[model samples]
Target: MDELAALTKLERVYRESSLLCFTETWLKQDIPDSVISLTGFTLVRADRSEVESGSSDHNLVNLLPVYTPVVKQQSPQGKEVMIWTEEASEQLRDCFNITDWDVLCSPHGEDVDSLIHCVTDYIHFCVENTVPSRTVWCFPNNKPWVTSELKALLNEKKRAFLSEDKEELRRVQRELKYNIRRCKASYKKKLEQGMEQNNIREVWRGLKHISGHGKSGDVLQVIGDQAWANELNLFFNRFDLARHRAPSSLPSRQAIHPQLSSFTPQLPAQHSALLPTVTVDQSTVDQSTSTPFRLTLDQVRRELKKTKARKATGPDNISSRLLRECADQLCEVVLFMFNLSLSLERVPALWKTSCVVPVPKISHPKELNHYRPIVLTSHLMKAMERIVLSYLRTQLVHL
Candidate 1:
């Protein structure tokens, strides 16, 4: 008997070995009642650990509450049917001002008669069957029940099926939750990394200095290192320099700056004595008399002055503003590219502390880089100027 007792004790210990270690931590974090509410069946104390274990031992065990599924005798698996009860029918008929007799009549009589038959059949089947199932007949106007013959009709297998379905649904929900958490964590990490990168560059460059390589000989040279110098040299060697246009102004007739004189072409002077003095030929004179009136050049100039004084001042033009904005946009793009390149570490020497100058404060749009906000504004201004000038020219032609 002692030997038999010892063998049984060993077997019992082995069987219990698979059970959860009810450590203090696990005990304290017992499943909440709300979690229990999600299940259809109550969990026993012994099954708690089994239900709680997830895929791993370190992972929390999850238990999905079991429940009996409500077996609905749908017309066809794919087709959806609304089940209506007797009390519900009466309520709906009253609510909608429908005829009571019409509702109770044959399925073919009333518009909603088919709905009533479906409900009646489902309710009758629930009462007559011998299984563990709950039949809920939902009707319009919030009616939910019919006959009270559902005591002996529920079955275990059906309940198990419903429980399994619920478990599967819970599993899917858990997976989705985990995935969402993982994705959120990853996204946050990436965002923080980007912010860190930005901070590094911002601090290293300081506030005023340009972040990347500085410009030299119209070519961007890396701030430091042999590679950058070589690249800069190669780039500048191939880079073509562009000439800027001079601002428009009144032309000077007198001698001025040598550079201006060199660029300007000399105009031909009019020789007053080139034409020979001619006397009106008496033979060529016609005998017919004509009106001999013509206005003097001085009188014509006086008349033009009077017309100019009478003209109205129109709305101000934006040509000057347009040009300034274009310049600003170009500047902005250049600066942005510089800063961006600095972050990329392409030009080490330019981004260094010693060589770079403090960034000058830009008060106007003209200071912006060409590729940034200024470019868009500049293009718009240009288009507007073109349109206004074209319209003005057309109007002038008409005038």
Candidate 2:
């Protein structure tokens, strides 16, 4: 019985022999490895007898095994949605009305880009300050039919369930069911309205929402990392580099049109007489007839009014809704800027930049070609373009 007990004790020691620690072993260098070593175990030693700071070194070594809790990384947040109110819109218009336009008009030789930047920045500041915004958390598995009210009811139902209250649970469940039905009906109505208006984008969004198969979030997730983003950037810009590459050989003008190289034609008598032989002095020209076509306040206002309220903003972060809402107050400044731009024959640099959004063409996109680039440009620039187009159209009709 004693031998059996000893064998069991040895077996237990061997089973738990992963690590063995010892301290305060008052031995000398003469104590060889054979004396301290055990079978099937390797030994390690730290000799501090010759060191001056033996105690401090021992303390430092003891502190090395301190615990550090693991920190969990958080998921990226969703985009912030601004809540535009009637009062806020009114305030924004009022703010615009109060702003002085003389600063923009005062500088005669000021850069067009600077003037445009100032105007857009001021408008953005006013809108941001006046409008209220909130962040809506979007989860991967979130359903479009789940409204805030429904979520609150769900929480109540969960509490009731935990508390074992049958009546409360039943009441909450009924409310939840009703809300779900109402939300679904409203959502369906919105989808119908989108279809009636022929809004293809909204229609596709609705279909994706119902089917729970949106590729936007998935694409963003895949490209969120820097490695994938760099690869996509290189891939997308490859064509640009190729297009701008210098050619090896150039074609001569004569080679381009071999027949024109030796042919020299003379004008007919009627056309030759029509050509002006004398240069007209600038001072003698009619000032009224030579004046450039200028933009009118009414034209700017009309274009501003035509701006779609819910359209996405450009790189400047200025919304179309603000422009449409404050058309009356903004038309004068826009008129002045447009005329100045016409006189100088220059467009604002800010207007030339656009925000590019990559939209996926397939459900699971692997290649960069599977994405379509959608550009969002400045609404103000577009308004100016429309005014210019109208003027050109009228001029064309007369010709």
Q: Who wins the TM-score comparison?
A: 2
Worst window of 10 by summed lDDT in candidate 2: 56-65
**TM-score list, all predictions:** 0.14, 0.62
lDDT accuracy of residue 315 in candidate 2: 86
lDDT assessment of candidate 2: 0.72
- For each candidate, what is the lDDT? 0.34, 0.72
- TM-score, candidate 1, is 0.14
Task: Give candidate 1 regions above 4 Å deviation.
Answer: 1-265, 269-371, 375-393, 396-399
RMSD to true structure for each model, in Å: 33.6, 14.0
Query: With candidate 2 superimposed using the best TM-score fit, by how many Å does residue 136's alpha carbon deviate from the native?
Result: 1.8
Model 2, 164-217: lDDT tens per residue? 799999999998899899999998888899999999989898798777575444
Write candidate 1's Cα lDDT for 35-103 as tens digits: 333334433232224543322233222233343223322221233333344554343324323223233
Best by lDDT: 2
- Model 1 gets an lDDT of 0.34
Runs of candidate 2 exceeding 4 Å displacement: 1-77, 103-109, 162-167, 185-205, 213-289, 360-371, 397-399
Give the clashing residue pairs of candidate 2, or none.
none
